[model samples]
Target: MQAILEEYLPNVMEIPDEFIEATQETIYMTVYTSLIAGVLGLFFGILLVVTRPGGILEQRVFFNILDQIVNIVRSIPFIILLALLVTVTRFIVGTSIGATAALVPLIVGVVPFYARQVEVALLEVDPGVVEAAEAMGTSPIGIIFRVYLLEGLPGIIRVSALSIINVISLTAMAGAVGAGGLGNLAVTRGYNRFQTDVTWVALIIILIVVFISQAISNWLIKKVSH
Candidate 1:
C-alpha cells in the first residue's frame, strides 16, 4: 500500500546503505556460485549425455556414478542441504556463516541441478551434429563445448535464468542466519518487530529485483536466439 511505503520509507531510506551492502553480498554470492556451478554443471551434463546409452562418450560406470550423484543432490531439499553443507562450507570457506561463506554450500548445492538442466538442453541438440563433430576429429571436450553447448545456448540461458531466480530465493532464506539482505531486513526488523509496512516494502523490493533479473535474462536469450 502507498501508506506502507510512506510509513516505512523514512526508517528504510537510510536502508539504501544497508541494502547496498546486502545487495553486494547477494551479488557476490550469486555471481561466483553461479559461475562455478554453471561450469561444473556443463561438464557433468555433457559427460552424462555423452556416456549414456549410445552417447559418443558411452561409459557405463562413469554415467551411472554421475547420474546417482545428480539424483542425490537434487533430491535433498534446499534448506536441509543448507544445514548439511555447514561443515563442508566451513572447510571450503574457512567459516560456517555469512554471505561469502554461504557461497560454498550454494555452489555445491546448485551444481547438480544446473548440470541436469544443461544435460537436458544439450540432449535436445541434433545427435547428427554431434556425430559430425566427432567424425571431424573433434575431441570429446571440444565437441561438447563447441557443438552441444553452442547449439543449446538459448535453452541453457533459460536454465541459468531459472537457477539465478532460485539463487535469489535461497539467498533470501540465507538471511535467516544473518546473511543480511532485503530478506534479513524483512524477517528480522520487519516481521519480528510486527512492522508489517517494513515487511511489505522488503517483499516489494525483492520482487523488483527478481523481475529485473527475469527481464534481463529474457532479453539475453532472445539475442542469443537471433
Candidate 2:
C-alpha cells in the first residue's frame, strides 16, 4: 500500500488541467445554484419567520401552508428529487449532460435545505427586536428584511456556508447521472478502474472545498456581526 501510494501520488499530483474541466464545472454549477437558492432561501426564511403565529404578520394559515411545503420537500430524498426533476432540468439547461444540467436539481435541493437553515437561524433572534419593530410601525416586509434577517446575519452566514458545503457534496453525486463533476472523475477513473489514488485525490479536493467554505463563512460572519 505504501509503495503504491508513493508511486501514484506523483502522477495524481500531475493530472493535466483537462482532467479537471469537470471539477471546474462542479464549482460553477454550485456557485450559480447557491446564488439562486440563497435568494429563495432568504425569502422563504423571512416568510416563515414573519408569518408564524404571533409573528409580525401572524397568519397561521400562511404559516401552516409554508410549513407543510417545506416539510414535504425536505422529506423527499435528494437522489429521488434529482431523478424526479429530469425534465425540468433538461428544459432549463438545454442538455442533461453537463454542469448546467445539474443546476436545476442543485437549486431545488439547496433552496429548501437553506430555507430551513435560514428559518432556524432567524428564529433564534430575540423576540423583543421583532416586537420593537412592530411597535415602531415597521412594515411586515421591512421588519423581516431589516430586523430579523440583519440580527440573525451571523447564523445565516453559518447556514449558508453549510448549505454550500452540502451543495458541493450533492454535485459530486450528480456525476452518477450525465452531470459532470469531481464525482464523475472518481466514479469513472478512480473507482471503476481500481485507482484508489484518484478517489483519494477527489476526496481531498472536496475536503479542501469544505474547509475553504467554512473559513470564508466564518470570516464573513465576524466581519458582518461586528
Candidate 3:
C-alpha cells in the first residue's frame, strides 16, 4: 500500500521546502494585509457613515471627497494596481519584489474594497438605536463606537471575513510580480515547469486555508449574533 501510494503520489507526498516557504509567505501577507486594511477600512467606513447627510456628524464635503477616493481606488484592477504601485512599494518597503514588498500593494488594493464593505455593514445597523443613543445625549464619537460598531458587529464580522478572503485572492496576483507565495510557486514550479502535481498541491493548500478562515469567521458570526 505504501509503495503504491508513493508511486502514484510521489510529487504530492514529497513537497519541497520552497513550497513551505511560499505557504508561510502567503499566510504572512494575508494576515498582515488583513490587519492593516481592516483598521484603515474601519476608520474610513466610520467616517463615510457618520459624515453622510442626516448622520450623527453630517459633513457632506468630507464624505463626498472620501467617497470619490474610495471609488477611484476600488475601480483599479489588482494586477494593474500592483504594477502601478511599484515605486510606492519600493519607497515603503525598500524593495520591489518578495513577500514583504508585496504587502504594500496588498494593503492599498484591499483598503478601499474593505472600506466599502465595512461601510455597508455599518449602514445596516438599526437607525432607531442610533437615534435613541443620540436622544440620551451620547456624543457622536460615543454613539459611533457603541451603537454603530457594537450593534453592527455581526455584519462587520461577515464583511471582514469576506475582505480577508478577497485579500487572499489578491495575494495570488501579488505573487505574479515576484511576491513569493503559493501562487508564485504554482506558476513557476507547476505551470512553467509542467509539474501539474505541484500546482494541485498549491491549490489544495489554498483551499484549505480559505476553508479554515471561512469556518472560523462563520463560528464567530454565530457566536456574536447569538
The candidate that wins on TM-score is 3
lDDT by residue for model 2 (1-226), tens: 8677568675465564735786698788778988999999889988888889887778999999999998899888888988899888878878777888888888888888889999999999998988888899988878877888789989999999999998998899887676887888888877888778778888888788779888999999889987
Model 3 residue 184 distance off true place after TM-score fit, in angstroms:
0.3
- Residue 99 error, candidate 3, Å: 0.5
Strongest candidate by lDDT: 3
> Which ten residues in a row are the worst by lDDT in model 1?
5-14
For candidate 2, the per-residue lDDT at 161 reads 93
Model 3: CA > 4 A from native = 1-5, 12-15
Off by over 4 Å in 1: 1-10
lDDT of 1 at 184: 74
User: lDDT tens digits, residues 50-120, model 3?
Assistant: 99999988999999999999999999998999889999999998999999999998998899999899899
Q: List the residue pairs that clash in candidate 3.
A: none
Worst 10 residues of 2 by lDDT: 10-19
Q: If both were scored by TM-score, which would come out higher, candidate 2 or candidate 3?
A: 3
Better of 1 and 2 by lDDT: 2
Candidate 1 at residue 146, lDDT? 95
Clash list (residue pairs), candidate 1: none
